[model samples]
Every structure is written in structure tokens, then in C-alpha cells.
Target: MCDVGETTWLDATAQAELVRRGEVSPAELAEQAIARIETVNPKLDAVIRTRFDEARLEAAGDLPDGPFRGVPILLKDLGCTVAGETTAFGIGPLRDVAFPFTSYLAEHFRAAGFVPLGRTNVPELGTTVTTEPKSFPPARNPWNPDHSTGGSSGGSAAAVAAGLVPVAHANDGGGSIRIPASECGLVGLKPTRGRVSQGPLIGEAWAGSTIDGAVTRTVRDAAGILDVIGKPMPGDPYYAPPLPRPLVQEVGADPGRLRIGWLDRPGLEGYLDDPECRAAVAGAARLLESLGHHVEESAPAAMYDQEIIGHFNTIIAADTEATMRAFELLIGRPIGEDEIEPRNVAYRRAGKDLGAVAYLQSRSWLEAWARRMADWWTGHDLLLTPTVGAPPPELGWFTAAGPEEEGVRIISFIPYTAQFNMTGQPAISLPLHWTPGGLPVGVQLVAAYGREDLLVRVASQLEQAAPWSDRHPPIHA
Candidate 1:
């Protein structure tokens, strides 16, 4: 039996090899994982739904034969469908909620040989950065319990950082994947839109702004997972050309003297860069320069477009309303007054208020901006920006007294993440910087659509230089 507790901290790839060699059994790994979750999760509130009995049964039964074999992984509650498991997506929507049948992704998850331990927390509809949703208490950063773990993938990030699990399922529509990765110091890669499917369930999520991926402690784990499940199913809305069989094979491949447009300053929030964020970005920029990559100060031409920002926000708010309406229909109720958050009400109301013209105008603006970004990336292979425009806001910043507080300034600080959502490109948050206050700061690297190979390859190079897997929270098992 495998005891992750006693054996070397083998990443997913190495662990699979050990499993094949009979050095680590799924039962042993599951027992150690359950123990870790018991000891560590109380501090972070990461794993919201634990299927301990189910996990044990899985370990006792026939395991899927894939690269990850017995690795324990958790799915973010918001973006995925697990049969028999209801998706509350934050706002306490579990009243008689349950998955009616299995999803294609669930089958793929099993095919990857990943043992599903349970689900993790996300903001209501994954609309916010702080994981403090009404459904479950906000997930606290394992590094500092008082500080927030970033969301809507916050739980997955916390779990990986605290060693509760090596890697967990995470998704990003806006900055959900990168935000939590920055806060928790993990490798968060938001694959190009449609790189992974939203199918055999729902076709598109958030107007295709968001897509699914994982947050892992090591780059190689991310690479292996992508290899197993990254391909889009046939007859999809869109598809990126297939790469080599193992994405990890490209890791450490020459990034070469590529031109990397780097920004030490935050833009989307309009002068919202904290001293810590700037310093972190600056330091990371220096590291990239020394690492043989050409770094140039460049800002997205789209950064100055207020119309685009408004367009993105309006669409987001409107989508919030649409999703709420869908939930109401799902539950066979009107969603009753006071069932959703106050800020959300404002946004949803704003969405509902928009007439047909405003929605169409928003669509036009998105097409224009995507063209602009494509032209910009055409000249440069990649653009580097601060992962989060502002550092993680203090916990409870989003919901005061559980959403009674309205128009939170935290939303204003989050513009840097949404544009990528609109552009539908591949972006990632690498934990390359940590503040003097000991908070991790992330720098985002983006590639043109279908060029995740570039981002992940570059990330592997950066990982070797500034390894984050060794970094850990003060609280640990």
C-alpha cells in the first residue's frame, strides 16, 4: 500500500510509476490523503464536500489504469458535474439539489485514473475572487488563515498548497484559476477556451469566457493531467490543434530568446497596483531577464478601452442574472427574494435591465477587442502581466454580513482578469513573486489562442528557476 505520508513526495507522474511498481497502493495513498484532509482542511475549509466513504470504496475496488492511477483529486463545485452530486455553485442552492446523471467530464476524470475525493468551495456562481460564499464559509489561505485564499478556485488552490492533495480540478472563466493560484502559490493554467470540454452536460459556460483546468503544486502534474484529458471531443464548437502525446515533454524545451512583453505595473484597475504587487512583478521581470528571455515593458493596447471594460462587466452581470434564472427553473421555484446575495442582485438586475440593443452592442465590443488582442499577440508570442491587478482583498470584503453590503470596491480591482475571459486566450498565473509581507504574488503569462504549449513550456522553465512546490503554508499536517 502507498503511504504518501511516508514515501517521497512523488508528483503525479512519479506517483503513477510507483503505483505501477506496487510501491504505492491506492488504499495507502487514500488513507494518507484522508488523514491529511482531516488534519489540514479544518484550517482552510477547502474541501467542502468530502466523500471519504466513497473514496475508500474506490480504493478498495478496481482502479482506472492511467497515468495518475490512485491520485486523489477534487473538482471545483461550480464548473463541473459529478453524477449524484448537486452543484450549488455557492449560494446555498443544495435544497434537494443533485446531479440527475453522469457527465462526460466525470467519465473522463475516471479515465484519467484520478480518484475523486470530493468537491471544493467556490463563490456564488463563481462571481468573486474571495471564496467566502454563502453556501460554505470562505476558504482561508493555508499560508495565513486570516487572509483569503483566492477564488472561485480557492478551495482547489488551498488544497494543493497545504499538501492535502497534490493537485485538484480548477476552472477559470475570469481569473478564478489564476487568482487563487496567486493567493495560494500554486501553478494555475487556464487553457485556451474549448481546450477542455463543457459538453455531455452544458455546451458553453459564461459566454465561453471560462474554461476548465487544474491547480497543482508542480508544473509536471499540470502537464500530465492535460495530456490525459485536454483534448476536445469531436464535433465541438472549436478546437486547438493537437500537440505531442505528453505535454510535459515540451516542458524544459527551449523557451529560446523569445520576446516576452512584461508589465510590472497593473493596468485594468487603473492605478490599482499595490507597492507589493509592483515589486513582485518587477522582481519577476528581473528573473525572466536573467533566465535568457527578453523582457520588454509593454501594456495591452486594450487596457485603455473603457468601452470594452463596460461591455465585459455588463455581460458578466447579465450572465449572473441568466444563471440565477436557470437555477430558479432547475429548482422549480422563483429563487425567492433574499435567496441570493445583494451585490449579485444589483448585477443581475443590471443584466435584466439591458435591452436587446445593449446586449448586441456588448457582443460587437467583444469582437473588436478580440481582434485588437490578436493583432497585439501577433507581434509578440506572449504578453506578461500581473496575475492579479491587486493583491487578495481582505476576507469578507465581498459580502458584508452575507451580501447585505453592496457595490464592493473589490470588484473594481478585478478588471485585469476579465479581458482574457472576453478574448478567449490561454493565460496562466505562476507563483513567481511573494510580497515582503510574505503573501504570494503571481505574474500572468498569456499566449495567443491555441498556444498553451508556449505558456506551459515557459512555465516549466520558470518552475525550474523558482520552484514553488517547496513553498508551504505555516499550518500543515
Candidate 2:
């Protein structure tokens, strides 16, 4: 039998291979992961809930014969709901509420043979970039427990980086996946909008800016998992352009000489000009140039439009209000202000006060802004930038002053990632640089809509050129 300690560090793809080779049984894998979570989760508070008994039973029973059979995975508390499990979405009132049916994405994860051990933590309703919710213990960064783990996928990223699990389910609306990946030192891919369905319950989230993806330690794991879940489901409102082949096939494939634009400065005014972040992008540009790609300093003009912040907030306010209503329907009562976070309470009020015309105006304005942003891709195969405007901040950084101050902090931290969510483009965050303080600073590579193939190819090249798989956080198993 393989050492469980060594197995804990293996990526999801490798763990599945071990199961296939008969070197490890599914039950053994489950037990190892459960032990790691039990040992490590107290320090990080990453796993908010556990289903260890159910996981063990599933691992011992007949399992699906899929690409990732026997691999244990964590689901984010916000979405990707499984029947009979609580998806509290980091809200205090809804903490015990369980959904009756599984979401299509969760079904895909199970069909692809990932056993769900538990759900990770998230900010209330995933409203903010950092994952410090009042409802649960904040997810501490594995690299430095004092710093924040970016969210609402922060819990999953922390768990993965800490080696509690190889990979975990993460969805992005505005940098949730990539932000956490950047902070926790993992690979986070935000697939093109509609690439993964939110069906049978949700058609769109945050005005179609949200999409499901995962954070992993390897590019191939990201590609392989995307292949398993990035399929069109019935009743999906829309679908991304189809892939020519499975994404996993693109790993290590040559992404012929391509023109890439890089940005080191903040995309929006009032955002940070952090030295570490700028250095991360500059370093990635130099690396890309060395790898035979044409790299130049450039970015979309639309990124500077200050209107984006307000419009994005408008959509979020509306969605936050709607989400609260949805929860009320589920729990059969009106949620009081005290039960919700202050920021979300303000959002709900703003959404309730917003007239239909004003809401439509914000949506229409963003639609036009997306078109302007997409034009940059006409001349460039990729855009490279810092995943977050700064490295991970200390815990409570976002909430120290209150929601109003938190808004400014959020914009400063995440100016680069939310735009792609609006434009429906596929973007990835790679842990290409580490700060002098030993914090991870991720550089993002964005492809045109539905061009994950290109992103995967170049990411694999970068991964091979600068391998990060061996780099583990201080809080590792």
C-alpha cells in the first residue's frame, strides 16, 4: 500500500491512477482524506461540514467507472448542491437547510467519480472576495494562517493547498475561484459563462457572470476535471462554444507562437499598485517571452471605465436580494436583518429599492461594456495580469471598518478578475510568483470566450517550465 502521507499530497489525477492500479483502494483513499481533514481542518477551518461516514460507505460500495473514480473532493458551501446535504451558502439562518434535488454540476462531479467528503466555507452568499464570514470560522490561508484565504471558494483553496484534499469544487462570479487560488497558491480556472450548467434550480447567477470551476495544484488536473464537468446540460439557458476535443488532451500540447498582452498596473483607478502584484505580472511576461510567445504591455480600454464597479454592484445587489428571497421560500419565513451580514442587508435594501428601469440600465450598460472589452481579444490570443490586485491581506482586513469600507477594499483587491466574469471569457490564475514574505502572488492568463484549450496548452507549458507541484504550504498534511 502507498503511504497515506504521500497519497495525501498527490493530485486528484494521481490518486485516481493509484486506485486504478490497485495500489490503493477507494476506502483507503477516503480514510486517508478524512484523517487529513480531521487533523488539519481545525487549524484552517476550511471544511465547514463533513460527511465522513457517508463518504466511507460510498467508497466501499460499487462506484462509477469514470475518469476520476475513487478521488475524494470537497464542494463549496455556496453552490453545487447535493441532495440530502445542507448548502447553507454561509448564511446563519439557512445553516441547516437541505435541498431536495442535486444540482447538475454536483451530479457531474459524482458521475465523474468524485466522492464528496464535505462542504467548504464561504462568505455569506459569497458576496465578497475574502472568505471571512460571521456565520462560520474564517478560512485561514495555509501558507500564513494570519492572512486571508480569498473566497467564496477560499475554504476549498485552503483545503487543497494544505493537502487535505487534492482538489475541490470552486465556482466564480467575481474572482471567487481565482482569488482564492491566488491567495492559497493553487491553479484556479474560471470557465466561460454557461460552460457549466446551474440547472433545474438556477439559470444564471449574478446576471450570468458566475460559472463553475475548480482549484488544483496542476494544470492537467484543472483540464481533466473541466472535461468531466464542462458539458451542456438540458435546460441550460446557454452554452459555451463547444470544445474541439477534451481539455485534458490539450495538456502539454503546443500552443503555437501567439501574441499575448500583459498588464502590470491596476486596470481600474483606486485599485492598488502593489509592488508584488506588478512584479508577478512582469515576471510572467518575461517568462512567456522566453517561451517563444510575443508578450507586450497592453490591456482593454474598457477596464478603466469606473462605471463597471457600480454596474457590477447593481447586479450583485439584485442577486443578493433575490438569493435572500429564495432562501426565505425554502425556510418559509422572512429573514431578519440581524440574521444576515450588514453588507448583504444593505445590498438587499438597495435591490429592493431599485426600480426595474434602473436595474435594466445597469445591465444594459454592462452588456455594452462587455462588447468593448471583448474587442481586445481580436488582436491578442491572451491577456496576462495579476490575479488579485494585491497578495492576501490579513484576516478581518475586509470587515475591519464595516461594509462601506469593505467595498473599497474589495475593489482594490480584485479589480482584475471581475471584468472577465462580466465578459464571459475564460480566465485562469497560475501561482507563478511568491512574495518575499512567502505569500503566493498569482498571474492570470485569460483566453477569448470558449478558448480554454489555448489557456490549458500555455498553462501546461508554464507548469513544465516552472513546476509548482512540489511546493506545499506550511500547513500541509
**Given candidate 1, what's the lDDT at residue 402?**
50
lDDT of 1 by residue, 42-107 (tens): 888998888889989997789988788887788888766776777778778553488676666677
For residue 355, give model 2's deviation from the true position in Å.
Answer: 1.6
lDDT of predicted model 1? 0.78
Q: Taking the tens digit of each residue's C-alpha lDDT, what string does model 2 give over 1-52? A: 7777779879999999999999998899999999999999999999999999
**lDDT score for residue 327 of model 2:** 90
Candidate 1: stretches off by over 4 Å: 2-4, 7-9, 268-271, 401-408
The lDDT of each candidate is 0.78, 0.92
RMSD of each: 2.1, 0.8
> With candidate 1 superimposed using the best TM-score fit, by how many Å does residue 145's alpha carbon deviate from the native?
0.4
